[model samples]
Target: DARVTQTPRHKVTEMGQEVTMRCQPILGHNTVFWYRQTMMQGLELLAYFRNRAPLDDSGMPKDRFSAEMPDATLATLKIQPSEPRDSAVYFCASASTTQGGFSPLHFGNGTRLTVT
Candidate 1:
């Protein structure tokens, strides 16, 4: 009955500050996803990995955001010199699927981040 867990459910920081968000994906799940939700992007997929191998992160801002997996149950997202436009809800998800890459993702409550 493992579940995805996220830290710092809410954060407010001035522009140009650093923000670190963390997530713990479900145990035994082989796929993980990072997504950002906003009115503009509309739940853009940021990054995904299976079996600790990165799949894609082209949707994320290459300059400020970075996502990584330190272990099977751990994932992290960091934003350096964040801007006001970067404000959004960041979610982490994991799934246990036999199929290749079409498994539905199970998302955490998400880290609600707001940059001033």
Candidate 2:
């Protein structure tokens, strides 16, 4: 079965440290998305890519956060000088388009981050 896989299921870091999250999208899927979930923000789409190319990332903080797809199957999100406020569960999801419509996104288990 197709599935999105994420690594380092949990992370804890001090303020100002660097944090990186990785994802392996389902094979043959052309779209990938990153989301951040928090009590205040609910679930926010931070970025999304189609055909392994970034389409938008306006919801992400450009100064310290970045999202990228290094290849067809791998995606990454990074935060530098991480702050306590950045702590949240980050999710990676992937989808494919069919003649009928777009397939529903398959989400990864998410990486829970904690900043001290």
Candidate 3:
């Protein structure tokens, strides 16, 4: 069975500080996704990749956030000079391509980033 793990379930940082969140995907899954949820934005798809190939990242705030998959089981998201508005829950998900982009995704508990 595959299980995902996220680091620093809660993080409080000063504004303008750099924050890094990490995710460990389930074994054998090739697709990874990053999502952000806020009170105003609700649930938004920040970025998604398949087989480490970026499929789409249009929903991400290109100016401050970046997402990448270093390997099959590892994914990372970094924010530089993070602002107060950037405080939110960041979740990472992984899925297998059983039928070409039609597999169920397993999500981590998420990293709760609070910029102060």
Candidate topping TM-score = 2
lDDT of 2 by residue, 27-100 (tens): 99999999999989898999999998889999999999999898998999999989999999999999997787
As for TM-score, the candidate ahead, 1 or 3, is 3
Superposed by TM-score, candidate 3 places the C-alpha of residue 43 at a distance from the truth, in angstroms, of: 1.6
lDDT (tens digit, per residue) of candidate 1 on 1-116: 56799998999999999999999988888889999999886888999888878889898888998888988878889999899998999999999767555456788999999999
lDDT (Cα, 0-100) at 48 in candidate 3: 91
> Which ranges in model 1 have alpha carbons more than 4 Å from their true place?
none
CA deviation > 4 Å runs, candidate 3:
none
- The model with the greater TM-score, 1 or 2, is 2
Q: State the lDDT at 55 in candidate 3.
A: 93
* True-structure RMSD, every candidate: 1.3, 1.3, 1.2
The lDDT for every candidate, in the order shown, is: 0.89, 0.94, 0.90
> Judged by lDDT against the true structure, how good is candidate 2?
0.94
TM for candidate 1 is: 0.92
Model 1: which residue pairs collide? none
